[model samples]
Target: MIAVSLLEEYGGIIKNYKSGDFIFEEGNRPLHYYQIISGEVKMNNYNDEGKEFIQGIFYKNQCFGEPPLFIDQMYPANAVAVIDSEIIIITKDKFLDLLKNNSEISLKIIKNLSQRLYYKSVMAAEISSQDPEHRVLRLIDYSIEQLNFKKEEAGFLINFTRQQIGDLTGLRVETVIRAIKSLEKKGDLKIINRKVYR
Candidate 1:
């Protein structure tokens, strides 16, 4: 994560967005660098049939939309606030300057992007050929690693909803529900108080 103090020192302003607000739409020109100060944001796209595919979900202290900004290209996916959120944003020029001046931050960004690329590759394979249960398990494992889910005495808690899992793995909600139950029966995960833990 980029240092919050550095952003504030560099004149980044906190902007509040209501849930369901479009932070940026697909095909829009990139203009600012954004880091979530609080709450959630998701990058997503919809198919012809109106089915939503989530590209990624970002939470507090996470940054999004940097790849397009660096490449000077239009946004390839839409960013929406998943909850009432506050984001720290700086002008594109300032953001570029910040990265150029901070080797540590730049290296961190590179590492983060590399992890994202690895996840994308794995998920692509799962979506292409894996069975529903396998895909769901892979997704949960990936989220545990990437999101740094804390493991308790029971297991690692999954914070995502079933519908979110469905979108991420290209499965229907009903399929996700069934697969989760099957996974639980197989001792792959545990359900407590209606929440899934793995």
Candidate 2:
């Protein structure tokens, strides 16, 4: 498997961590590329008010630490562990070497960056829409179509707290709650044990 190959090639440098661990902090120079072998990683940024805004979430086998790969710089956002995790870290130099030697990986990196950009645009456009309830649905649609998430894991892995969702979707938390209630009322979605499903 590709996973096995990546591990065999880069496993020695990985670090194991627990929930609440800070994988990498904002403003920190990123010297490595992070590959999540298991568990979840939250990409967030904090406002001056000290409120954290969730930007992206990675599930098992997903990866981040990309801006470093491109511009040789620090990340503007924080990468945090939302669950116990194992991460394989490939140094920036090593990753650059790999990309230079392997065109396939370089192409994959380009594709990933393109996808990230698209997601950014979609989120911005959806949040800018005037309809708060539609904003919530747009957020859900963006997650399902863009992130390849199922209806069930929408609220969890997209994993925004109500406040975070409001911040991201440009809605008030109370409005988000009402919208979710509306969805439930229409039998279009269901939440049970903190999970949402259609």
Best by lDDT: 1
- lDDT tens string, model 2, 1-198? 025365447532778889999998888988887888888888888778876677887777777868665786778888889889988887777777777877887787788788878878977887666577677766776666655664344343444556756766656689988887788788765767665554
CA lDDT of every candidate: 0.93, 0.73
lDDT of 1 by residue, 45-83 (tens): 999999999999999889998888889999999999999
TM-score of each: 0.97, 0.84
Model 1 residue 148 CA deviation (Å) reads: 1.2
Candidate 2 off by > 4 Å: 1-4, 10-12, 150-164, 170-172
How many clashes in each candidate?
A: 0, 1
Consecutive 10-residue window with the lowest summed lDDT within model 1: 2-11
C-alpha lDDT of residue 127 in model 1: 98
